[model samples]
Target: MTRVVFAPDSFKGTIAAADAARVLAEAWASVDPGVSPVLRPMADGGEGTVAAFAAAVPGARRMPITVDGPAGHPVDTAWLLLPASDDAPDGTAVIDMASTSGIELLDELRPWDADSRGFGQAIAAALDHGVSRLVLGIGSSASTDGGTGMLRALGARFLDARGAETAPGARGLGDIASADLSALRPAPEVRVLTDVTNPLTGARGAAAVFGPQKGLTDPSDQQQTDAALERLARLLALDPAVPGSGAAGGVGAALIAWGGTLLPGAAEVAHLIGLADAIAAADAVVTGEGAYDGQSGDGKVPSFVASLAAASGVDAVLVAGLIAPDADLAPFTASASLTEVAGSPASALADTHRWLHEAGRRLALAMRGSGPASGS
Candidate 1:
């Protein structure tokens, strides 16, 4: 009887992390009835981050706010606030960038001219409500103005060479030559949760990795994004070369400049959930996400699980919707093996449950060194 643990992030539109794990366990039980499976639903400080943190800290409260979504529509955004303890008078609050500015909210790849000003507005509101400690999840954002829009919403004025406040769009970013934060206020404590280590500028920056996804596929769009990033980075006095600075459309740059400490998103989640401790007791651990590849190495779900499994001397296996052909799984191979869910990526994406069952049966067969009987 193998002691297995299933810790996986959501498969995006297919299934929630918890449900996915449950399905995997069901499939595993079909092949090996005695196998024990532990479930740990996870996220990477983007979507569903608030729920994850709330699970870790029950003292946290969920507050709703109407903020601008990817389509510039008002969305019922939520953030987590930790209740004050005896030592701390005010509570700690967390702002998920995805809640206010994620690409998932967009219906189609429309050219968005607006900046991240909406995010700043949301944070400021959280502060006004007596949150002394603020945690910002800086990934899955839609803007690329180096967080200038967020700063503007937070009371920092961005001015053009003509000494006029820039407009609240992409065009406005190009004219920004300076920024004034004297009128702004901030919480005593602020931290940014980032999943990547790319800098705020240059070839390895936001424009390179995430720009295309944001509908900035053309040269003109890329140049515009680059220009906006340049202006914002200069205004913030950031090196523009710091790792993780480009995350969340350069929200990482602004937050860091605003005194926000950056931490690995998956690591933070793992620590909160005692992932290492859980892995230490398991014989086999299963981990995965929507897609697994080199990008997963940067504090993504599977990579983090693999790391924990390694520390515990347990074997980890990755099951994903699609495994990139060129993906270097060696890092996960140290303690885990990668496996595709179905016949092809498209098929798996179409039917997650079917693929999960296939994966679970494979895992069971691998463990027992035998296949299941027909219809048994």
Candidate 2:
């Protein structure tokens, strides 16, 4: 009997990762009745991180804390505590960057004119919860202050060249010429989980890769943003050229400076879920996310899972909502295949189940070597 493991990230607006896994599991059961299927939902420490963790680890506790959304409003967010120290009783807490400062929350609160004050508060709350190690999922953030607000929430201060406190948003990023970490008060054990490796400065840095998303327009101002990031780094007494420094608006940089270790978000979570063991034991491993493209290769959940499966001598397949040109991930996995659902992008969004089933049938047939000539 074939042992298949289905691990998929959320399909974004379409389906949850668990639901996607169910769809794949049902497909495999229908095609190969004897196959044993394992379902594992994955996340990049972004939007569904809390749900994914809650599903994987029982006794996970959740507490609501107000944090700065992308635009700087007090959005009600959550901090999840898992099995940790004896004093806390609850496990280590999972601090979702998204919960406090995600794009969705930003949109709801109009983040363009806001700051990240609440994000800082959320982190402080986690520390107060007696969390042994704070797992800061630094993705899907709404702020472009390079985590200035996040640092502020932890007691770090951003000062301008004139030595005045800067406002807690990107607009004031240009004036930031220094940082003061002497007053910072973060937990002793903190790990930042991020997918991006871009630095906090330069052309490939935060302002370049993510500024536009936060409504930055002037190319000249990008340099200022980079400078602001560097200033923060200097305040923390560290180098800003570190990889992942640009993640979540430079939270990675702030975390590193503040004694937080940086880790690959998806890979770390996968380890927490015993993904490698599952891959080693499976006859075939299937992984995917909301979308697949060149970016997926950069330590994204699907690509990371593919890499693990390949190392374990397991064949893998990628099934995604949208398949871009470089989304053909077979090149990276030793014996991998890529398949997309049928229907236009809009149709797929409108009727997710139909195409998810279609995609599943197509994948199942491919696995059995009886699939059609083309997915088109």
Candidate 3:
């Protein structure tokens, strides 16, 4: 029996990574009943990070909670609790911003008003449960408040010149005259996961590189926002030039202030889920994400997984919802894009699973050096 590993990140607005892996596995099995398929869903500390942990960890449990979302509305979400071990005496709490306070939680961009408070609230909840360590996935963040909203929820106080609490989100950044970290909760061992390495306040920094995506496009606007973050960094006594400090619109810097360590998101997730060993033993591996482009080569899910496969001399197959026209497909032995298979981008996204199923079938056949069977 040929062993094949199926690993796919969430399809962005459509299927989850776990669901994508399942769908691809089923499609492969339909084509080759003798094929052995292993499902190992992947994430890059983004939206599907928690779900990926739930699938990979043996005894991970979901702890539900309600917290204020990015749009200042209540959101029901869950954090993952991994059973205690010698390495982690009091167990581990896994929380992701995507479910807690991510940009996706808002109907529209709240560049100035969206906050990371919900993410901090969830962390506080996990801390209340007495977890000794934390694994925070701070991707898809909604605000550029320099993480003041999150720090506030964790017991830090951000006050204006008059000694009054400032407004929430980036809107209040300019008003923060002082921050009181005296009341902040005691630090627990924290590992902040993110693939971004942008600095905190310069040209390649958070406000300049990512602020535009969240609606702070003008150079003057980004400059002002960057200045605010710079001010916060000075107050907190953390370096603003450190790589990855600008991730999630300055949440990374805030976590650093809270005594957490920054680590590569995809690499960490891959290690936690044991991707290397699995790939070494498999004949071939398949990995994918929503979009594959030039940037995908730089620390993204597909490239990381493909690199592992290559190290083991295993054939790696790449599949994606959409493959940019100029994207280098050299990492994989073969590749498929839902957009090409489904005719149009709209058609692919409208019924993503259908196209994914088709892509899986096509890839499975291609692996066998065979053409499609009949109309399949």
In model 3, which regions exceed 4 Å deviation?
Answer: 372-376
Ranked candidates, highest TM-score first: 3, 2, 1
What are the lDDT scores of the predictions, listed in order?
0.74, 0.74, 0.91
Tell me the tens digit of each residue's lDDT in model 2 across 49-149. Answer: 77677667667777877665666546776887787656444457777777777766744433234555666788788777666677778777776776778
How many clashes (backbone atoms < 3 Å, residues ≥3 apart in a chain or on different chains) does model 2 have?
11
User: Which stretches of model 2 miss by more than 4 angstroms?
Assistant: 32-35, 85-90, 108-112, 159-164, 176-182, 331-340, 373-376
Q: Write the per-residue lDDT of candidate 3 for residues 264-369, one digit (tens) a residue.
A: 9999889888889989999999899999998899999999999999899999998899899778889788888998898899999999999999999988998888
* Alpha carbon deviation, residue 123, candidate 2 (Å): 1.9
lDDT of 1: 0.74
Against the true structure, candidate 2 reaches a TM-score of 0.87
Candidate 3: 10-residue stretch with minimal lDDT? 367-376
Number of the predicted model whose lDDT against the real structure is largest: 3
